[model samples]
Structures are given as structure tokens and as C-alpha cells.
Target: MMRQWGLAFSFLISAFSGLASVPPDAAAQDRPAVSQCQAIARTLPDVVYASFSASDVLPAQARAEAVRITYLGHSTFNIETAGGVSIVTDYNGWYRPAATPTVATMNKAHSTHYTLNPEPGIAHVLHGWGDGGGPARHGLVVGDAYVRNVTTDIRSGGGVMEPDGNSIFIFEIAGLCIGHLGHLHHELDEGHYAEIGRLDVLMVPVDGGLTMGAESMSRVVTRLRSSLILPMHRRGPPITAFLSMFDDSFDRSYATGPSVTVSLRSLPRKPLIHILQGV
Candidate 1:
């Protein structure tokens, strides 16, 4: 898939390099709620309707706790733990130098995965299959955090069409397991759910019908029964569709600032979905 970069993001790729890629597959799953969200994908426009400024973004040096998490745009995010463990997801192009994480993950299915090696430094870089050749690997560890990636096929273009492969990532840090769903083109079944296991926080792709769609994302959330939901990979019309459908009662609200900090001890006992401001 072609990846369109936000203006500020255009600089990092250098004078060459086109974009990243992901593996495709055959996928199809029915989600009643997602059907409702399809309306949003079809009707809404991109989020550029409202302009965002750097002042609105949190300062990079601002402390993020081992318990602190901040959504960078789309599937890209920075998670810093109190004990000095930091991880980022989809190190896609939509982030700045400051937002770059020490340990970042790359999904090979879409434009928003992986990255050119950072000038500062990167502790670990894990590749989600389709981009690499081999049996495919899942599970990683950086400091006190353990990470894993799972793959499933997403059928596109109508009846059982398969394109690129997709992956769902789970990062376990300080006992809390957080999952990030990337360019997922379909819903998960029982087996997929079992593989996903219990999630404390879920980073979802909410492009409505455009990218796996909202209904599908919701279904995963329901089964995973995660405590937090960080909506991503959404802009324009789809965001409206996703937000409209996410009207259930949970300890839900936007985060404190652009990023919300947390630690193992502060973990929630009950499920709560917090929409943190995306970078």
C-alpha cells in the first residue's frame, strides 16, 4: 500500500528510499458493529479539517513513566517505563526524532512500519514478517519487557482476495501486556483470540472499512477484554465512524495531555479506555 506522509514527516526518508511494505493475505470476518462503522469511512473526510500545531504536542523530554504511554500518530507510539525501559510500535514515518524509541518494532505489511536506522541509536528493532524471508519470528525481549508478533491473513478486494500479510503485536512490560494491531484487514476468530491472550491495553487501527474497519477492531477489543484502547491509523472520515461507534460506558476519556503516564502499580483493576492525544 502507498503511504502518504504528513508534511513534517517528509524529511526523514533522505533523498532516496520510497516507503516500507507489509505482507498480504486472504482474510474475511463478519462484524455487525463494523458494518455500522463503514458509514463513517464512507462519509467522513480526512482530519486536516482541524489544524494541529507543535504546541499542542507534548514536549519530547517530558518524562514518560514505565507506566507512561503516549500515542504518536497512527500505529506509532512511545512507551517509557519507570525503570528505564522504552518501546515504540510501528516506528512508521509519522514521528519526530524525539518521539523515536530505544526499542522499536516494525511491521512489514504497510508504509507505516519500520524505519531508517535512527542517528541517535536504537537498542532493538524487530521485524514483523512479510518483509523478511524465513519461518517468521514472534516474541522479543528488551530489558524487563517481552514482545511478540502474530500474523493472520487479510482478504481484500471482495470475495477472498489476499494482498499483504498483517500482524498484531504484544509487548509485555512490567507484567502488563499491551497489544498493537497493525494494518489488520479482517477480524480474528477463536484461534486468533487465543493467540492474542489477555491484553491490558490495546492499540487499535480504526480506519473503519478502510483498514480492517472499526467493527473488526471493536470485536477484537471485546474478546481481548483489554483495559485500555488507544485508537490509531485513523484520520478524516474514518475517525468519525470509529468514534461514533465507540460510545459504550467505560472509564473512558482523553488522556491528561498528549501523553498519559502510568506504571505497573497504577494499573487499572477494571477496564477503562483512554484516548490519548496522538503525536
Candidate 2:
């Protein structure tokens, strides 16, 4: 799987580099002011959507439109866009993959979710909490992907609410919108929904208590309405409990391997829970 992804990623890097460069000023002028979710929701097709569960059999030429998602255990996922942008979510000092990511998104809820000293090779290290301000704000576009964050409160050791202590990082790439709910502590509100818009894929922590109760997280999942769900940050017992919360409205599948390639064309007609095997 890694070998196949590497080939595709390298090809995309070369292909994207050869494209005519857009001046920063001109690119900024073309960017929309609305959130990615709202933008995708407006353009959703009326026909029934479909999903093709692919392991590592994709052709190298399809790399241009494919977004490969590899679970790196816990809440960390390596997202490689067709434009060759690489991102690691909830990046801890450990669970480092062989490939050095261009962007690393971290949260402060626990030591395992962040690192103060990241590798020098990483170009962008985004923290979810503020350095001293209210909440951290990240809006960056690299190659073919745009990354941004939405703040959420977390529970302190004493169980007190730590405002804006966590983040929900959203990545818009390859014409698909993906979201990572990092260390979510409480249920979402209207403001969150408005900011989140429509997600084609969601990476959520289903550890029952670490992030939230299974029932609570399930409700949040229902509200988000993502076409595909990736489970993370859970052991066997927790994963089983979390799975039981979903009803007939959703379907569940276990991946034979750690990575699954996706594209806008492969999103499911109904919501799905994909249990990737890397963990």
C-alpha cells in the first residue's frame, strides 16, 4: 500500500509543479469567502452517489484525482492529496510515518496529540489552541489542498471546561471535504454546524470516554451527515460500543488494510463507517 501511494504521490508532485503557477494575489481573489462545507453542499449532485472500496489496486494515472487516506493509529491520519500535499492530523511525537509530512495539525487536549518540537522538515505546524490569544485560526492553501480549523472546548484534568482548547481541522482537497474531530469534549452546536457545512468524510475518535460518550458522538455524527466515517482513537471494546450506536441509517465495513483511496466520485450514497485496520 505504501509503495503504491508513494508512486502516486511522487507523480502528482511532478505534475502539479509543471502546471502554470497562479500568482498569490490572483489566487486570493478567486477564493470564496464561505466555509468549505457550505461550498460543497451547494454543489452536491442530485443523482444517487456511489462508493468503490479500493485497497491498493488503483492505477497510478488515477492519482491526479485520488486522495489517499492512511490511518497511522490513534487519532493520527496521513492524508495525501492528488496535488501531492501531505498532512498529519493530531500529530504526536510518536506514530511518525516514514514519509515526512508537509503539514502537521495538532491539539492540546493530551500529550499524545501534540509535540512542541516537530521535525525541521515539516513546513507548517498548526496548533489548535492559542499561543496567548482566544483560539488558533489556520487558513492555508498548499499545492492542491486548503486546510482550516474550527475551535472546540475540552475538559481539563479537573473536568472544568477549557475554552477553545481543541480543534476540528477541515481539509478541502481533490474536490472532497474531509474533517478531523480532534479530542472533542462536548456536543456540537448550531455554530459548529454552520462552520462545518457538508463533509464527504469524517475522522472521529470513538473511544467512548476519552473524547465523548458513544451516544453523544453518535448524535454528532448524525448531525454532520458525512458520507463516509473513519473510526480512530479507540481500542476493541470502545470501538465495539461505538459501532452499536449507529442504526439502520448507516452501514459499517472493515478495511483489509490500513489505507483506502478516495475521490469525489467514490463517496457513498448512504453514510458508512469504515474501520480501517492500521490500528
Candidate 3:
């Protein structure tokens, strides 16, 4: 059922543009129910800066309503939804929360980005790359969250372009669209953007060299214009360089801790670069 739509979307990508596209099935709302993030197009204003504490513990009322995002270092993040569904993004063997994640998504760009052997308790393990020679397709509702992916190419060992080698996983939960850019190696095109749709929070790779250059990556950020940008796969100077590109137009914020609880009501009025403590 879900796989059919995913496969159809994959075929659409191959048949038309080399880039991924949102399938008719998804556009027709035949799959995992549509979310507010996809339904509403938010136009946000420009710059402001603020420092705040991103508490690990959710407030009483928010505990059953908001989405908790915790940066576990590198590209791995533990995203916990109100419905008790936990998802780990770029799930390598290390850098995870104490409890096992209900859903684990992995990319195979490097060993740090994924692991072949995930823990036994995980209910859903989605690979960014496909089994044989096809795009990794995912569109499903797990608990209260809707998860899907848009495929992208990756740089292989010999510098060849491996089609559909990576996936940008989008999670619709707590009325927010959260996207994790997995080991992304190239700049996205119009079709890719169209497939991705709206994102409230975007988890991106800021390692200027390993993924893509700051200039190119920043272009994608500007186009997406997500309210909150969470930078991952960061090293020393690249993080500074990446933020500098948006300094004039985007607000910058430093979180006291690794965790932040976000709901539709909590999104920043202006676009912000939220730097978590560990990453």
C-alpha cells in the first residue's frame, strides 16, 4: 500500500527529471495522511538573535503535545514524538539515546552515518539507499508521525555519482515538518525542492567540504526558508562559515542543551539557526 506510492514516486523521478518529484498518489492524499506542514505555507520575516535554554525535559503540557529533538552528536538525532514514537536519524551504531528508537533511518555515505547492524528492538529500519538498483522509498505512518523520503545522489568512492544514494527524510509530527538531510553531497534542483515541500525544521549537514560547499548549501537553505535550521555533521570552521552566509538575513541562537521541544506554536517568527550544545 504505502510502498506502492513510494515506488510510483521513485518511478516518476526516473521517468521525468533525474531529480525526485512528489508522486500523484502523495499529491492525491492516498497515503499517510497530509500534515499541517504540507497544507499550510508559512511566509516568515527576517533577522533577530537570541540565546535560550533547550531543556532536555519537556514541560508538563508539552510532554503530550510537542516534538522533542535531541542532537546526539554527528548526524544522529533522537526525535521523540508525543505518541511515544521515537525516531533516530542517520542512525549509526553509536550516538543514540538510552532507549531504543522505534524508527531508525540510515545513510551509507560513511560508517559514521549508518550501521548495518541496528539494535534488535527497532520496529522500522529505513535505509537511504535501495536494496537492488532503485531509489530508497519510504512513506508510512508510525504512531502519530508521518515519515517519507526524497532521494538524492551521492559521491561514490571513485568520484562517480551514485543515483539515489541518499535520502532527505521528512517527518511530520506535532504539526511540524522536520527534515533530515542525510549525507547530502550535491545541491538540490527544482524537482527535488518540489518533492520536499514545506519544512518547519531542517536538519542539515554543515561540513562545508564533506557534504557540499557552504555557498551551495546555503542556497538550498535560502530556498527552503525553514523557520528553524539545525546544523549537523559539523566541524570547527565550517559551522562558522555556514552561519556567516546567512548572518545578514537569518537570526542565530545558541541552545544551552542538546534537546529542544517544538510544536506548531513554538516555531520562531523569523528564520533561525539553532545551534545545540553538543553539535
Candidate 4:
């Protein structure tokens, strides 16, 4: 039954993509600004999972149209889009890909989760917190991707709740909604979920202590239920402990390398916890 549903969904998405591929002059005037992923979420209550094996490498041509996600260790991920856009999530100074990204996002929960000075040649730098008293605001479109943010609170040095201190960045690219939960310190409310929309791939902080506890973070994972869950900010026992919470419901895959290429049509059929190489 589930298999049949997945096939149908894939077919429908393929047809939708065909229509979307029409020249911009033909559909630009009629197309809505809302992302394709969010539109699907609004119409379909449940996001049917698609099929892709993380271990299978694709040919160069197919990979050119896909998004490459590299786990650069310790809460940083370099996300490269097929259209030549590269974004670094939780970009503290130390961990980074060889080439500077087109955009870099940072959070203020800790020093490691952010950096004061990023390397040269980066196109944009988005801070999760605002320089003034207000919350950070980011709605940027570069190449084939649209980047946005939903503000969330964080715990300050005194352990008091600081409102709108963190941002959960969402990257909409290639008909997929990829999100990074940056130094998340609490469970999400309905409003936060609404703003975030649906996430096909989620880069989550699974440290279990500094961000949030295993149990609480597990609840967040259960609620989002992203097709692919990439655990970042990993510490030994917490990674194992967090996976245990979803052992029955989610499939676990340990990728041979630190990077994985994914496309809209290549999402996993079952919810998967994909652990990449390196901490």
C-alpha cells in the first residue's frame, strides 16, 4: 500500500516539474511566490516519502542538477546547489569547505555556532540574531535557491530565555525544502512549525546538551518528520541515544563519506537518519 502511494506521488511530482520547467516568460506572471514545497504541504496533509538510497552515487549529469550537502563537522554544512549557489550553515570560522560559499548563516547560541569574521569572497552573511534589539530577518534569493529564516528564542549566558535569539534557516532549492535548526534550544510551537512549512531534509543539532535534550529533540524530530534527517553537532553517546528514540520509526544509514547529493526525486522512501563521516 505504501509503495503504491509513493509511486503515485513521484509521478505527480514529475508531471508538476515538467510544467514548472516551462520558460519563465510563459509562467512567471501566473506563478505564485510561495515555494513549491510549501504549496504541496498546504494541499497535502501528509508528505508521502520518496525513494533514494544514500549509498548509491549518481552519474555526473544527474548530479549536476542535484544539491550536494557536505557535513563539514561540528554543526557546519556546506550546501551546494546545481545552479552554482553554495551556502554554509552554522558557519563558525573554523570548519568550512575549501571554496568559500555564496552565503553563510550563523547563530548566536555559542561561539562555535557562529563567527565574528568570515573569510573573503563570501557573497552574503546572515546572522541569526539582530545587531539591534529586533530579531534577524533574512529573505534572500540567489541563483536557483530562495533562502529564508524563522526566528526562535535561545538561552542566554544567565540561562534566561532570550526571545528571538536564534534563526532556523530554510533553503528552498530544486523543488526541495531543506532546513537547518541552528543551535535550537527549545521545542517548537505550532506557530514556528507553520512558518517553517515542510522540510524534506533537516540538518539538526543532536548534541543533546547545549542545544536541547535527547527526549525533547526527539519530539521535535517526530513532529517535523523530515524525509532525510542529518544529525550535526554530534557528540558520541548523544548521537546513538538520539537515534534510539526513533529506531522503530526511522531507518538509519551511515554514509561512507561526508557528502551526499540529493534531488527532489531522490528523497528517501522512508524517514532516514543519515549520519555522515566525521564528527
What overall lDDT goes with each candidate model?
0.56, 0.77, 0.77, 0.79
lDDT of 2 at 61: 49
| Clashing residue pairs in candidate 4 (N, C-alpha, C atoms within 3 angstroms) | 50-269
Model 2 TM-score on a 0 to 1 scale: 0.81
lDDT of 1 by residue, 117-188 (tens): 543567677766565544345554444455676676655445464533567777755445677887777777
Writing each residue's lDDT as its tens digit, candidate 4 over 1-279 gives 566545545654554565457543344344533454444344444443343222222233433368999999798999999878899998998988898899999998888888888987888899999888899987776766778899999999789999999999999776677999999999988667767767889998888777898889988888888889999987656578888888667999899999999886678778899999985
Model 3, 1-279: lDDT tens per residue? Answer: 455535534443342232114453354354434433332121111221121112222233432368999999899999999889999999997887999999999999999988999999999999999987889988867776778898999999899999999999999775567999888899987667767767879998898878898898898888788888999999656468888888666899899999988876678878889999887
Deviation (Å) of 218 in candidate 1: 1.4
Comparing 2 and 3 by TM-score, which wins? Answer: 2
For each candidate, what TM-score against the reference? Answer: 0.67, 0.81, 0.80, 0.81
TM-score-based ranking: 4, 2, 3, 1
Q: How far off is residue 44 in model 4, in Å?
A: 7.8
Flag the better candidate by lDDT, 2 or 3: 2
lDDT of 4: 0.79
Q: How close to the true structure is residue 195 of candidate 4, measured as C-alpha lDDT?
A: 75
Candidate whose lDDT is highest: 4
Clashes of 2: 0
Relative to the unseen true structure, what is the C-alpha lDDT of residue 39 in candidate 4, on a scale of 0 to 100?
46
